[model samples]
Structure formats: C-alpha cells, structure tokens
Target: MRRAAYWLFPLIAAAVAIFIVIFMIQINPSAPHMNDGTDGEESDTSPQITEQSGSWLDRFSISEEKGYFYPVNEVSLKLTDGGTATVAAHYRLTVPLKSSYELFCVKEELKKSELPYFMRKEGETMTLFVDSNDQNRLVSLVTKLKTYQIKATVSPYTEEK
Candidate 1:
C-alpha cells in the first residue's frame, strides 16, 4: 500500500500535465512550415498616408504662371441676412500679405470657415477678394486672420472692367 501511495500521486500529476499539454495544442493548433521560396507575407494592408506641405488645389492647374493663385472655385456668396448675393465676384481687394508664409498661417482658418474666395499674388501686393456681399463674412474672416497674427486687410476692392 505504501509503495502504491508514493507512485500514485506522481503518476496522476504526470497524466494531468500530459492532458493539459494535449488540450492546449488541440485548442491552438499550429503547422510548422519551412521557408517556402516566396515573400512570407500572405496579405498586405492599405498604404499609409503622407504629409504634404501646401494645399493640393495648387497642383490642379498646369500653367506657366509666376504668381499662381490657388484654385478659383465659382462660389455664390451667401448673404448674412439669410439671402444669396451674386455681386461678390465683381469686387476685389489687395491684401497686405508679406509672403506665402502669411497665407500658410491663415490656411487653417480658411479651411475651417470655408471662405469662398481665392487670393492672387501680383507684384509685391497680395490681393484678397471677398466672395460674399455680406460685409459680416468679410469682417469675420479678417478678424480670424488677425487672431493668427496674419493681419489681413478688409479693404474695399473694385474691379474696373
């Protein structure tokens, strides 16, 4: 009986350990493979995104322009008093923009507010055309620009046809 008792415990433990290993392998079975003369990747995910410096709209047009303005989208300016105005296109103003760097600083605001005007550079002066007949929109845009220290002008613009 003493001999049986001494061997029984170790025998039971060994059996349990063997069963545990077998169960584990059965649950998560794996197949071993030798290097199959091909790239190990079975599938690939989509590519990563890239960080661009300037607006993508600048690349849309192909022209030999020294002072190329960004994409000029035809926008119908919405009046602040719940109306639409068609007179925005006739007006233009020259912004006191020092460099392209200044426009870059206000880029976020332009995108956030969805200002519907394009700026063109001529000589040493950068021009900003207010796209809306609503004076409030113009004032709001200039105020936001001032917040960014860009100091964009809200001066009146007239286009002589």
Candidate 2:
C-alpha cells in the first residue's frame, strides 16, 4: 500500500499540471502562424501606421469653409469611460485653417454622465476632440478599437471648387 500511494501522488500532480496547461491554451489559442517559421526573431513585415498623428480631418476638405467631399462610415469613436459613439455626419471645425487645422464631425450615442455631453439624434454635429499629446488616451482608445478588427486607411481627398 505504501508503494502504491507514492506512485499515485506523482500521477495526480502530473494530471493537474497537464490540466492547467490545457486550460491556458484554451483561453488564448495560438495564432495560425505564431511559431511556424520563427527563431525568436521579429518578422520582416513592414511597419504599419495604426493611427493618424496630425489633424486628419483638417488636412482634407472638411474644414469650416470647406465641407467634406467623402463620407465616413463603419467608424466608431470610443470615450475614456468605455462609452462608444457612432459617426453620424461630418461638420466644419471652427479653428483656423492653418492653426491645428481641426475639423468636426457629428456623432450619435447615449448621453454619458461622466462627460456631461449629449449628442443630438437629429441635426447633431459634435466636435471630435483629440489631443495630439495625450499618449495615454490614444493607447486606451487603440486597445478598445481592437475588438472592431479595423485597419486605418488614408484616402486621398480632392479640393472642391
């Protein structure tokens, strides 16, 4: 009986370890090509621009005197408090054309109590405010954006007469 108990203890421990490993793998399934041809070195893929740095809307023809020629779709803005706002319409930015060159866009979402901000269901044009220096806000927003599985695109805009 003593020898049987000794073997049983090791067997139980091994089983527990295997179970834990399996559970971890299940929780975070490895990507298809995570380890197919890598030797602990980074891949040779080109760097991607995940987010635009400067005032993107201002650069385009979306300024106050000039309205946007193209429409934005499938874009969602996430707030600091985990609240999300859907892009409704594009508006003009009141800032100077050369001063930061900011543009505004209307967004529709439930009123958030944290910011005391409300979006109009009709004729609602809200200013999209973003701080170029706020790295923390940018990181937080980028993390939340991963759930949408979207890639940023830079579309060429033509000046309207």
Candidate 3:
C-alpha cells in the first residue's frame, strides 16, 4: 500500500502538469487559428501572395495619385512609353548651408540658366521644381548643379488621365 501510494502521488502531479500545459496552449492569443469552420476556427481572409503574381504590387491596389510621383536627382531621358503618360520627374536638392549668403549663391546660379524653374524657400531648405519632359534642360540643370556640389534627386510626377 505504501509503494502504490508513493507512485500514485507522482502520477497525479504529472497529470496536473500536463493539463496545465495543454490549457496554456489552448488559451494562447498569438496562435493562428485554423479554418475548420468550428467555434475556435479563424476565417482564412488574409491576403496570400502566389507565384503567378509578379510582385507585391500586383496583389496590392494603388490609387492614381500614389503611382506617378518619383524623385529625380539627375535628368533622365526615359519616357513612360506604354501604361501611363508622365509629364516630368521632380527633383529635390538640399544645400547644407541655411545662410542667406549660400542661398544667394544658389539663386545666382539658377538665374544664369535658361531653363524655367519654380523656386520656393521653406525655412532653410530651397525647393526647385523643373519640368521632366525637357530632357535637354534637365541634363543641363543636373550638370550645372553638380558643378556647385549640389546633388539632386529625380522624382517622377505623372499626369492624371
């Protein structure tokens, strides 16, 4: 009787431990529920990417406004040949200096160019907008800007259809 009682005590403790483990697993919030159509099952509504889809972009839907804008550093001659019409690539160049002296230098350089540009000062940063369609002008602007140690980034601006 003593031997049986000793073994029984350990057996009961083991059973309780196993029960606790099972209960914890069942109550875990992070577990992904399966789609078995049962009370605890989760619906398989999450988006899945398949091999047939070229990229994540194919699976996702993008609005008209989000698709076209690309920043340009240097002028590129590439045109949107097929899907949509693109007017120009926008560029952003930041001069490290915020002083009016530096700003004046930049303004003078831009004034020397024949290309049409829209300039605005926001705080210490200067924003220059140029038409993307004119590849020659872009090339010239990029070349000239580079001489002044000003690097520009080309962003795409798409025309709405």
How many clashing pairs in candidate 2? Answer: 0
lDDT of 3: 0.59
lDDT of 1 by residue, 90-120 (tens): 3332356677777776666667867666777
Tens-digit lDDT track of model 2 for 109-161:
11211212222222443333322333443344434333443222222223379
Candidate 2 or 3, higher lDDT? Answer: 3
Per-model clash counts, in order, read: 0, 0, 12
Maximum-lDDT candidate: 1
Better of 2 and 3 by TM-score: 3
What is the alpha-carbon RMSD of candidate 2 to the true structure? 22.6
State TM-scores per candidate. 0.37, 0.23, 0.32
**Candidate 2 to truth, TM:** 0.23
* Model 3 lDDT tens row, 91-147: 433334445665565667767865455667778576666554555556666677677
TM-score of candidate 1 against the unseen true structure: 0.37
Stretches > 4 Å off in candidate 2? 32-161
